[model samples]
Target: MNRLPYATVARCVSSLSRTGLYQGVDLRVLEAFDLDALAHFSGMQPGALCAGACVASQSSPALALTSANLRWCPACMAEGLHAALFQFSPITRCPTHNAPLIQACPHCGKTIPYRLDPAAVATPLACPTCMSPLVADLTILAHAHHIVGP
Candidate 1:
């Protein structure tokens, strides 16, 4: 994705709000494409994509406000995609990969930026601190899976 200017993003958000496209939902959680072209561009059912983006408050415990630094599982990152659920504070582990999500870079101890610029960085998994790949140790993943019990 191209790096969009803040003004452009703001304008898009305002336009969407005016249209009531995202009624009663926080627009911050969605990416620019999701808000603008997801329904038109993707072949997947629009309902599935839309529903997956927002979680229902009644079904789960109240979530903590997302920090500027987001957390992610390195294993999941290796798949070349980031999961939206990783931004939720209550989600500590990757259910599919059985690995704990990491917020800070292991090498430089700096927090990963929540919104990554694909143009500036080769991939989202690259650490802004050490420029190293964000990979979790196998033993650590195994331990997490054992404790979390699938």
Candidate 2:
């Protein structure tokens, strides 16, 4: 994806330099993947994701359907995979594996922002603060999900 277009980045997600967090691509990006079909593959209930888990716009609803933090499943990360379903606030645990959604590095308790930057893509499975290995399997599919600077 070296020739990845700038328009796509401008449309999908935004890397926040000031806050060091990110506004991930629209949850609608997964719409084409069909939440129901994805849940079927993930061994979860389709309705769990049908609650209109839209990110908060003006904060009218006290409980936003989704969260900004990248809560992860230990089971999936152990296999070097990330499930987008973990982004929903309704998903407290991985239904398939029954593992809790983790928001911080267990070893250091440092919260990893749900960022979409090069460092995160470059070291996809390592805790930035403590350099802890988050992925036990470390597959190629887990590395550099984004284009990096030379």
Please state every model's RMSD to the true fold in angstroms: 10.9, 8.9
**Which candidate tops TM-score?**
1
Best by lDDT: 2
Candidate 2, residues 47-137: lDDT per residue as tens digits? 6544434333334363356566667888777655566568767889998899888988888998776544445554556787887878765
TM-score of each: 0.53, 0.52
Clashes of each: 0, 0
Q: What's the C-alpha lDDT at position 74 in model 1?
A: 73
Score each candidate by Cα lDDT: 0.51, 0.55
True lDDT of residue 41, candidate 1: 40
Assess the local accuracy of residue 42 in candidate 1 as a C-alpha lDDT between 0 and 100.
38
Q: For model 1, how does the per-residue alpha-carbon lDDT over 113-142 read when each residue is reduced to its tens digit?
A: 664233223443457567766654423433
lDDT of 1 at 83: 68
